[model samples]
Target: MTEHPDHGFLTEPEVTPEVRASYDSDVADHGYVMNLSRVWAHSPAAHDRLFELLADLARLGGLTFRQRGILVSAMASTAGDSYCALAWGGRLATEAGDAVAGSVLHHDDAGLEPADAALAAWARAVTRDANATTAEDLEPLRAAGFDDRQIFAITAFVALRRAFSLVNDALGVRPDRQLRDDASPTVREAVSFGRAPADRPS
Candidate 1:
């Protein structure tokens, strides 16, 4: 097992082939092992399964990269999870724009189009309190042209993201330094809550 002083709350797990593969994938994607990946390395199978399900839901919903960014940013911000907010906000900045991504992170959907705005609103509602959401909450999504299947997929997507965020936040997993450095100034400014970025990249 490779251990780092600042790698979340749990003790580092032994580097089995599964954990090594997870780290390799992170390096391939981001040029470094992400702090979140370090934490999830404890159970690489579970991590892979969660992401697989997320991918399936995304495909079922016909989600574009931008739409996924919106859903993740909105859900993370609403749930007070700065790690995802920063990560997705940076991605959203590239797909949308810095101001728009920052706006979504701040829960100000003014910069979004009607359909995107509807998605953001739905994500927030679901993250804030799923029980508080009524059938009426689906109206805006319907008005924005989403059919029942898409709506269901979108709801499930937000819920799954919330589940991911909950675990990271509860475990004291800080956002990676690369995420903070990569995020636009607008995005950095918008993410004002939850755990801070790690002192250095993992």
Candidate 2:
């Protein structure tokens, strides 16, 4: 993986066998080692933990790929997490149609299904200011047909995303060139807030 000098990592951490394996898997799965993979290389166990949590969440959440992208984009954007915003925004654009994804990213829920719009708003409230959310905030979701168990799963997903965002943002980890390049223009435009893209290695 190419290293960006200004990411504020004081020492280059050793790549353990497990880390190398994970990098190999990343390249195979996504065609490149993600920037987050590089940052988490400092602690392979942490890297493993993150993905493990995501895996478990995926099984329990039961949200479609499109729904997950929408939720992740909204939550990440609300929290000013540029990395996840761009990544998931791109996925949303690809999976749910550009117009719908663009609207969500732009913070305009026009034309979105009631369920999607409600989920988007809920994600924002959960990420930016959970205390501001009241029972009223949940009424929309319940009206949109989500049950208590589903609601709990959705909140868990949001919490996990916040955890992911905190790890990357606090450490100055930047978006990878491959990731940025692969995103659609609409997705790229929507994620202009928060951290700047990572500088490439000289």
Candidate 3:
């Protein structure tokens, strides 16, 4: 594994204007540079593209914010990514209530609407074993009233989220301290199956 980087941004000589711009937005949005953004600082182009994909999905509006959170939590939990699970699971808790968010992360889709449940299942399947998903796997989504375009958008969003999780998990980017400290107990407890922020070697 690549050792965790010491600086939040690249050294001045290596820093590009685009990188600085991205960092500036992170600070403005969250009052600090998120660990994931710092990891992406090494490649500003890739960072920009990842956020662009997120923005495109936001514009699609095929899913509500709460549904997106459930999907993200399901994917992150299935991928065994603690960083995303804590961060997005916290967001899911905020948007959908803690119990609902925790249930999604724990793979219990009991109270979710049929469509939301289908999306959650599909996200977990895609994250865990996309190759194993057959046409039958998509039937639930269709039955739940999702059109082809919506299904396409949801799949794209899941893939993009997995890309972000892969990069963070592979690079050993620890979850931000604020996320670890501030996440609800339910969210914190639900995402217990991956490398932890405290596991980073000194």
Q: Estimate each model's TM-score.
A: 0.96, 0.91, 0.88
> Considering every candidate listed, which one attains the maximal TM-score?
1
List candidate 2 segments past 4 Å from native: 1-10
Error of 3 at 64 (Å): 1.7
Steric clash pairs (candidate 2): none
Displacement of residue 139 (Cα, Å) in model 2 is 1.2
Output the TM-score of candidate 3.
0.88
**By the lDDT metric, which is better: model 2 or model 3?**
2
User: Which should have the higher TM-score, number 1 or number 2?
Assistant: 1
- Please give the RMSD to the true structure for each candidate, in Å: 2.6, 3.0, 3.2
> Total clashing residue pairs per candidate?
0, 0, 0
For model 3, how does the per-residue alpha-carbon lDDT over 60-103 read when each residue is reduced to its tens digit? 74688887888889999999988889888999899879888888
CA lDDT, every model vs. true structure: 0.90, 0.82, 0.80
